[model samples]
Target: MVGQWSGREARALREAKRMSIREFAAHLGVHERLVSKWEAGGDRVHPRPVNQAALDTCLARSDDIERTRFAALAAPEPDSGPRPDAGRSAAPGGYSNDAELLALIDTGAARGEGLAAISEKDLIMAAAHEASEHAGRAEGTNIGPSTLDQLDADITRIANDYVHTPPMPMMVEMLRVRRRVYRLLEGHQRPSDTSHLYLLAGSLSGLLANASTDLGYLDAAGEQIRASWAYAEISGHNGLRAWARGMHALIEYWSERPHRALQLAQNGLQYADSATAAVRLHNIEARIWSKIGSTADTERAIHAAADASSAAAADSLHDEVGGVFGFSDAKASYYAGATYIHLGLAEPALAATERTIELYRTGPARQRSYGAESLARVDSAAAHLINGSLDGAEAALLPVLALDEDKRIAQLEERLTGVRRRICAPAFRGVAEARALDERIEEFCGSTATRSLPPGSG
Candidate 1:
């Protein structure tokens, strides 16, 4: 049952496996560049014979039409329709890999002269230095005061837009801006200006770290936080330092390293006086305490957060960025409700959740974070289930279930998991509504809407 083969065919197989190029390459014991070449060549290119066998065996289990077609292509003596000379047309690799080019030069110069008499090597070295100088001059154009202001404004806009947008897409934009800011750092600038740039980088990394977390890449998020902390340290900005530490603590918390989370919170609190980071660090401490089931510690931390909130209001200093930095009544209530849920305080959790929803709906339109609100709804539903109000629980979660597939994030899914567990409790086992709820949730979970990401999601 051999069928046609093409680049489109190869691409479909790779995507069906849900692998990055590097992952696919690793799976096939091939280089990433080679895979790219294969895809670029379309019908003319195919995996080497042995590799074709591996692709067939590995992908045969998939029921998808695309993968099924891919299986056919992998079969012996497949028909490759009108082959295009894509490999010849493709440009050579760029000079981005300095080490590889240098290695080539080294191998070429390994003559009896012992590397001193290689004219070609000298020419390449000179050319590389000239190219670097040219790039440096081009980057220098970005070092003016006005350019710095533009960068600052751009970062602020991206940060402000973060709460309303999906993290997977914003992460790419953050990385792009971060790369541009890094380029600017290589140019000539005053020490103060350089420090300002570092602060901006720290803020961007903070946003990226949060985005990584939202997309369920906690390990990647942790590395981004480490980079953010370094940038904050170099800038010597107390607010940035505090924010970075709080973010670091949150990563540790999510990773289930509670002791490290508490330690990071304490470190952040040292810089917390008269800053909005004060409110954030205090709230983080309360969250850690709740995780450990320490009622007294949680209460003390919650009280400190309230005091910090009031002091922060008087100080007039605020986060230059948005997304993860700002602290508000709605945000505080949401955190408290989540903490209460961790502490098994059903009544207080419900109350805080109610306040969260009310404030989000009635407060400033700019302050509305739909992702946070969705989680709050899940919390409210879980609280209802705790009280044995099955119908109330189901009703509270209807809006969450109704969300557009793209709008459902990892946090919302995790929150819904708690509801699912509650629905299966002995009290609700015989309930028809409980079964219906489970079925509806299962259907939603199995949908392609949850699986099909938009372009550039990586």
Candidate 2:
């Protein structure tokens, strides 16, 4: 009784069917060594074209074996010849065959087995190839808005998932998938088609912008954001346009162009009349005001942001913008904490940071891991600075100082600078440690500040 077929069972099933390894290999038009490897477990066979074909052949033989066994069980005469019903159906509903193979693969993946063992990479590559082929077959034809919308959702999911995961070797391949999708949209020439195409383009641009930011390609991020803004505008997607503008403002802020950041944030507000995008727009505004030292504007924007966030929580009417936007209460709290930090309200900032950290920690491991480490560091630094514990501040920020100069994290660097400048007087007492940290921060900031985007580009 074959209860369950491991790779060994698969091989045994093939042998029981009188199919020699070399014969089977020849049948599949493969080298004999490959069959031996599959049988001996020398390598875990992925369900590629040849492997799948071999599996199918083996499964057919397994059905024959199972039928013979069942017929033998039913027969009264021990000397009966091969039963007619033998090999009728080896696996029930094909579940024990193809479905079981897939289940085994999925189980291995769930258990944290490497993709090398299961050929997960090959499966993904094959799917991508098929998608590309389909796209090619549909070339020079206009796909529906619904099709584009679904593609948008798919691409967004892929990008969002990969953002926190270790960069896969397939990153370039996935980006090509996105590029093809964008090319499809660009091929449509109808003026009436502009809105959907523009929306798709904006979404694609945003994904690329984020990828570039993660890889520390600040120039590429800036370019992608500009392209995103253009598409958002052309689509009449004011909310998305505002969102894109906010991204541009963020890039400016990161590049140390505070004035340009403020202007871009203000431009984002021009499209913030929509109830749904209001919170995001105000958040961007608050950050810009913090950069420019506009205490009054910053406070106003914070209040506005809080109100808009409350509206989102209340499930108020949202705009018809066809994408994910805004945040939940916990994410809003994180932004509020960040704003308070900028306003020099250190105690409240610390409290908000604590809440935000707690919330994210309780949610997903990926979410906890991404910014939580740095946020914890910055929060400790800010807390120590507020309490006049310069030594504690130095201890907290010294580790992060050794990180690669990431322009996207200019806010963190700026905060570190403030802490250093505040403590340079009596706390240092001419200690070499204090002097060294100060000089290192100054050098980092000097280089980052010099590389900022030129003003008036926004």
Candidate 3:
């Protein structure tokens, strides 16, 4: 009685509770013949619910029925396929560990070191190897949320560094990473796990768009942005989608599609209710309003941006903002200045520009140089023009004109053209300086006629 029950013992146990085959068959809701087949040991009976209940009834005082029932119902263990400590640290399906390798790249970048002289092909190989190891570790164990989060962080850091240093190489690596990550995620069973993958895809899409924009490939940039938007939507990441929309608006603004830019900016603002993204979207909205010569709208958007930025500063413990969307107070000021400039509010424009220059001076060197030089040129020219110093205005613009034509600061080029045409008054009877500045701008712009001002008053 103490030993494990065989087929005969199981049948005797079933019948000992005063249950005949017909009665037990009735209790089990099955035909008596089927119950007989089980009890007769014609074929070994696996414990069905009726047999289990009958055994439980007969052994009512026994302590082992629960164990017996569980053993009968338990599913077979799945094959783990590979072990972490095995010689092969990859899953049966050849999964890679790109996440850890990406982490190493990010750590190197944070220290301002290059990628250790590793070629793109080799770096990718390392990433694959690491991914395989991670998969092997994950095979039998459940992959936790923290592990996935770390993997995401690693990918973001690597992509950020890649974009900053060598964009082409980063683009190549990103495409490969994308394929690998997608395959790994294919086996994921959870919705939250899939969300992380979507977020990474969105980040890569935005990075690709940015690189394409920098390279002057607008069509490609547009395509990347669309892809990013789709991924962001899938990820349910509102802020990132808004940021991408803002960049898309910027492209349209620069392409001279003011109305379309304004529409896009409005759409971006709708999704950008979060503090940081709201400030950025508001800035883009202000820029669009400036392009369309809408002074009221420009002022409104700038004020909203400033308010949102102030709220963001108050809420954040650290000054760092998250994601690929880069928005700082200095950038806000720069956009504010540009808005005022288009509105012909020269004094306010000068004030905002000076603030931007001050902020930039304390920040990154390259950004500082670009902002300081451009702001100095515009501020000095505007100051001179306002004070009736046509000669001085020309002198200030001369230095700026002498620098290489930078499409990054295209607004400066436009402003110089305006200064040249507007500084033609007789009170500035010395037409020679103004004429020379005009010709220099014309040469730089590669056009004989002045560029058209934004619509309305100007």
Best by TM-score: 1
lDDT of each: 0.73, 0.58, 0.60
TM-score of each: 0.67, 0.54, 0.53
For model 1, state the Cα shift of residue 274 in Å: 3.3
1 against 3, candidate with superior lDDT? 1
Q: How high is the lDDT of residue 82 in model 1?
A: 36
Give the range of the ten consecutive residues with the poorest summed lDDT in model 3: 314-323
- In angstroms, the error of model 1 at 124 is 39
Stretches of candidate 2 exceeding 4 Å from the true structure: 1-150, 166-174, 186-194, 214-217, 273-276, 312-326, 366-369, 390-425, 430-458
Q: Write the per-residue lDDT of candidate 3 for residues 267-355, one digit (tens) a residue.
A: 97777656777888888898789778888888798888878875633211012223235566676777777777667676776678768
Model 1 lowest lDDT segment of ten: 86-95
lDDT of 3 at 42: 19
Best by lDDT: 1
Name model 1 segments beyond 4 Å from true: 1-142, 312-318, 446-450, 454-458
Off by over 4 Å in 3: 1-193, 312-324, 364-432, 435-458
Could you give candidate 2's per-residue lDDT for residues 325-366 as a string of tens digits?
434345556666667767777787777766775776587653
